[model samples]
Target: MMHQMRAETGPDGATDSVVSWHIVRNADLTALCGKTLSTAAPVQDATRWTLDPDRNCHTCGALFLREAPYFPDEHTD
Candidate 1:
């Protein structure tokens, strides 16, 4: 399971960007591993740690990239 979050710039860029958080949980993982599931942490924690840790969104493996303000225009072809 994969949770997808979308961040959209607000109207006129005055307000903060709109962020949507999607939570995806896989309860069948325990059955596959023959273990019990027990945790209180956020689903992101479990996914990043136990699953894909290097696929861009993993907090621990995520590298911060500083983009320039005038990088490029979205309408550029």
Candidate 2:
């Protein structure tokens, strides 16, 4: 199963741009959307992962659904 996490490209998640959320692979701590995990930001909750449309990175979301085909909180055959 693929693990997930949330991240941003801005410090303390404070950006004046349109994008805010970026999806990350907790296993390797890499972003599927090719975005920087903002490791330089203040300490953050690494477990703040979500698939909410309002905060999801569309690019990462699409890649995630295509690669895993199952939600982390769901059971699949």
Candidate 3:
């Protein structure tokens, strides 16, 4: 699992607004040397949630969508 976090200011003048996403991927083993491999879907740009809805994983060469965009705890340190 991987995590992506973004912070934005809301209309109420709060800069603590944040959006987080959980990225899940699969792992595979190479047949030749038995090396474990993993991949996370690659996005073209920073605005992936809006621009690249469907992207390809650079490592495993699979297709996946970003999911669970939510706010994290404000008190997180």
Candidate 4:
């Protein structure tokens, strides 16, 4: 099966606020591609809990809304 380009963001009230996904084609080119292309869904842009796993700093372990965003990297932008 061919996988179409898709993007999804964390649900509302979700502890994880990080945006995920990759850009497939530009908006102008998406139509020409003949495939349903999607972009990263934007959240409320509020401070939400995020956690990084010990294995990888780029990975999120867990997140608790209203708690704290924790990461093994010790820093985040």
TM-score (all chains, Cα) for each model: 0.19, 0.54, 0.17, 0.21
Superposition error at 41 for model 4 (Å): 2.7
Instruction: State residue 11's C-alpha deviation in candidate 4, in Å.
Output: 1.3
Cα lDDT tens digits, model 2, 1-77, are: 44555446443354433355555665444578787665543223323445246866778778876766654455645
Clashing pairs in 1: none
After superposing candidate 3 on the true structure, give the runs of residues whose Cα lies further than 4 Å from its correct spot.
5-22, 25-47, 56-77
Which candidate has the top score in TM-score? 2
RMSD in angstroms, all models?
Answer: 15.2, 4.8, 15.6, 13.5
Per-model C-alpha lDDT, please? 0.27, 0.55, 0.27, 0.28
TM-score of decoy 2: 0.54
Q: Which stretches in model 4 have alpha-carbon errors above 4 Å?
A: 1-7, 13-16, 28-77
Q: Give the TM-score (vs. native) of candidate 1.
A: 0.19
Work out how many backbone clashes candidate 2 has.
0
On the 0 to 100 scale, the lDDT of residue 67 in model 4 is: 28
What's the distance in Å from true for residue 71, model 3?
8.5
In terms of lDDT, the best-performing candidate is 2
